[model samples]
Each structure stands twice: as structure tokens, then as C-alpha cells.
Target: MASNGMESMQLAEDQIKILEENFNRVSKHPDESTLMLIAAESGLTEEETAKWFRLRNAQWRQAEGLPAQLGSVKD
Candidate 1:
């Protein structure tokens, strides 16, 4: 059971790494196709990928002293 928990944590860490790499290199507010690609790469569902982006954006905005609101992706 403890091993299972550790595996889960490691999996989560791997997923986060994938997501973070895409978020930094790609668009923070990715389009549907981009989101799908990222989700597939991260081994996450589309909804989960979207939620991760949303939460990450909020965290970044807070860190930058901006309001935690959704913003349009730059072209």
C-alpha cells in the first residue's frame, strides 16, 4: 500500500513535469487541439489538462501580483 502511494506520487510528479514543460514552451491557454495533444502527452484526460492549465495560470498570476483571472492567450 505504501509502495502504491509512492507510485502514485511519482506518476503525479511526472505528469506535472510534462504539463509544466508544455505550459512554458507552448501557450498557457492552449487551443482545443493543443490541449488534446498536451493531455495525451501528460497521460491525463482533456478536462484534467484544462483544469491544470487554469490552476497554473492562477498561480502564475498571483505570483506576478496580478488578479487571478482568466486571460486570452497571446497570438
Candidate 2:
């Protein structure tokens, strides 16, 4: 069971790497339509996509002294 769980995690990590690469290639711009379509194709709900967007934005915001708290934005 432990090995199976580890294998699953590894597979998920590999898949995420592939997806990130593909997304980077396709996501030339951070347009809403494109990201939403990609999110749908990538099996992400709008909420999940929003959360990811907020988190990514927050990381950048933190560097620039912008608000990035989870409560500061909707997920």
C-alpha cells in the first residue's frame, strides 16, 4: 500500500510537470478565455483555476508589496 501510494504520487508529479510544460507552451498570454479552456481540458474546475491564479498572483504580489493573503481574494 505504501509503495502504491508513493507510485501514485510520483505519477502525479510527472503528469504535473508535463502539464506545466504544455501549459507554458500554449499559454502565451494569461488571457481568461485561454486559461479557462485549458483548465477545463486539464480537468480543473473554475474554482480550482481561480485558486491557482490567486496563489500565483499572490506570490508575485508579495514580492511587490501587494496584498496576497488568502482572505484578501476569493478562491
lDDT values, one for every candidate? 0.78, 0.52
Per-residue lDDT tens digits for candidate 1, residues 23-50, read: 8999888999999999999998997788
Candidate 1 deviation (Cα RMSD)? 7.6
lDDT of predicted model 2: 0.52
TM-score between candidate 1 and the true structure: 0.77
Off by over 4 Å in 1: 1-11, 71-75
Per-candidate TM vs. native?
Answer: 0.77, 0.43
Error of 1 at 63 (Å): 0.5
At residue 14, give the lDDT of candidate 2.
47
Residue clash pairs of candidate 2: none
lDDT of 2 by residue, 1-75 (tens): 123122233325544554465445764334777667756765666555544555445555667796655464253
Best by lDDT: 1
